[model samples]
Target: MADIIIKNVYVLTMDSYELTQGVVVIENGTITEVAESTEQDADQIIDAKGSVVMPGFVNTHTHAAMTLFRGYADDIPLDEWLKNYIWPAEEHLTDEDAYIGTKLACLEMIKSGTTSFADMYIHMNDVAQAVKDSGMRAALSYGLIDLGENRSADVELSKGKQFVLDWKGEAEGRIITMYGPHAPYTCSEGFLSKVKKEANHDRVGIHIHVLETESELNQMKQQYGMCSINLLDRLGFLGPDVLAAHCVWLSDDDIEILRGRGVHVSHNPVSNMKLASGVAPVPRMLDRGVNVSLGTDGCASNNNNLDMFEEMKTAALLHKVESLDPTVLPARQVLEMATTSGARALGIKSGVLREGYNADVIIVDMNKPHLTPVYDIHSHLVYSASGSDVSTTIVDGRILMQDYEVVCMDEQDVLDRARTAASGLVERAKF
Candidate 1:
């Protein structure tokens, strides 16, 4: 018998095509059957009532604990924001603070239909605990920033390696771990090399920022005599196991290197625009066969939420304007970035609602005014649907939210603790 059965839903399998009246059977955290109809019984059943059912979203990159700083600092340049506000405030963050903040982030993500995410942040053990308590799947990493200091590099590397040893493949395989070197500008070549060596030794992936701004590119050129992508390539950091966020300043050569190395790109369209970062040549990267996934960066920079649906819409619209071609970044492609491409980036098997895939799925209420008269399901999903429309979120065959209510954690308690934590963090930061 299946563990759960979801029947009579408008399903976007995200594998090849859509099914108007589909039924899914999940057992042992894996999809057992997906078809137009199923006669089998299950321990639990969810009558979707014509709701739209699809694979749960995979957030390829984010600073999950920064949910505390969502609106604390905004309307500033990325460099200034980090130098003046974000970093200093982060210095005052404690493990408890991270736990509370991450709880809030998980709640928000669950409500918005995110089942899995890749998070780079400080105090990641606490973040992992939050993920466990909230029943969310995540790829966790400790943000390693050397800042050109040998001692800092040593300590950061030790912490990062220890984190991987402690938590990689933990939480019933719901949590994956990676090594996160903050960026080329923040970490030196030697430090990144050390991280790369350790990541290879452990057989895990590396997550790093690459060329997110013109200033960052210029600084990398002046210091390393090459663009950030080539510099990393020379350091042997480009590979299939690397997830590079923000290629907003890449040249054609950079795109070629990424494609050749089989590196994945996590494109944060909303955050990039908010920070005035240049538009990444996503169409060109796609043409080169680069797997470009979608993300909403730290909530501090994104200024309020972790909504992949909004990211999809903004990504589609942004590329159209950037290339001055209406044919760029179609709705279907953006949706793929949010689902299948994101799963591929994280090296997971949960993005498609198909047999044998992980049972991570979501149900979006289509009985709304905005979702009415859906001429095309994909078109409406990309151009009209909002995160608020999600009625259920499931990860690893467990329902975290159902009927718009989070079931894993106490929603009110998380919000209350988040408010308290954010207030205390701001006060401690003296900002």
Candidate 2:
């Protein structure tokens, strides 16, 4: 007997082009079968007659707790936004703030069909705890910075290392920890090297922001006479294990270096556009055989929400207009970036709806008027579909949201607490 079976649905396995009507069987937190018909009995069976069953999205990069800062500070340059507003406001965020904020983020993601994400931020224990309670998978890290005289490099690294060791494989293997060395401009070479060494020793990955803006690129050139990519490559920090977010200022040489180093790039088109940061060379990188994934950077200040569907649509449209080629980033490819490429970046087995893979799946309702007359599934999914179209979300064979009703956590409580926390933070920050 299977644990759960979803029948009479258009199954998009995402491993190939074939989208067929089939039944998916889930058991033991893994996909057991995907076929035209199943004779298996299950504990709970969903008759999704007018839905598309596909892999849940993986957000490769985000600051989850930054949900509290949504709309707090906007319309400012990246440096000014961070220094004058975001950084100052962050000092007032407490553990409860982080927990409630992350809980709110998890609630939003679950409703929007994202099963997992990679988050780098402060108050990560509270963040991890929130993830655990939300029943979502995550690659989490404590954001590390070592530039200012008041901050000790050793202490930051020690805290990061302890968090990695303490939470790795926790929450029934839903939580994967990494070393987050904030960014190139903020951390010195020696600190990045140390982080790389420690991450290698612990056999975990490194998540860092790389060249999100021209300002960072210029700063690196002024300080080290090289670009951020070259500097990090010299430090031996670029590799397959490195999930570098926002490679917006890359030249051709920098792209080649990233490709050669096997670094996975998280293209945060929404955040970059919101910040007025330059666009990344996603088309060039994909052509060079580099793995590019999708991400909606923190909601509070940049993206304003963790909607992978919006990110997918924005990515498809943004690359098309920027390159002046309508054929650049098509709907299907952008969908892959949000799914398989994202899972590949985080080294998770939850992107494809296949046998022996993690059962992180979502059911998108196609019965709506907007989604009707779907001649092409990919076109409608990428161009017309929104997060509100997701009717069901499942992670690890467990249902988080079924028919728009969230069961893992209390929706109203999370929203209320999040509002209260945001209010208190504003009062404290006085910005």
Q: What is the C-alpha lDDT of each candidate?
A: 0.93, 0.94
Clashing pairs in 1: none
Model 1 residue-pair collision total: 0
Question: Could you list the CA RMSD of all candidates, in the order they appear?
Answer: 0.8, 1.0
Best by lDDT: 2
Per-residue C-alpha lDDT of model 2 across residues 1-431, encoded as one tens digit per residue? 89999999999888864556899999999999989999999999999998999999999999999998988777988899999889988999999999999999999999999999999999999999999999999999999999943358889999999999999999999999999999998888889999999999999999999999998998899999999999999888899999999999999999999999999999999999999998999999999999999999999655698999999999999999998999999988999999999999999998998999999999999999999998988889899999999999999989999989999999999999999998999888887
Candidate 1 per-residue lDDT over residues 233-313, each given as its tens digit: 999989999999999999999999999999999999999999999899999999999999999999888847999899999
Candidate 1: list runs displaced more than 4 Å: none
Model 2: how far is 117 from its true place, Å?
0.3
Question: What is the overall TM-score of model 2 with all chains considered together?
Answer: 0.99
Q: List the candidate 2 regions with Cα displacement exceeding 4 Å.
A: 148-151
User: In lDDT terms, how accurate is model 1?
Assistant: 0.93
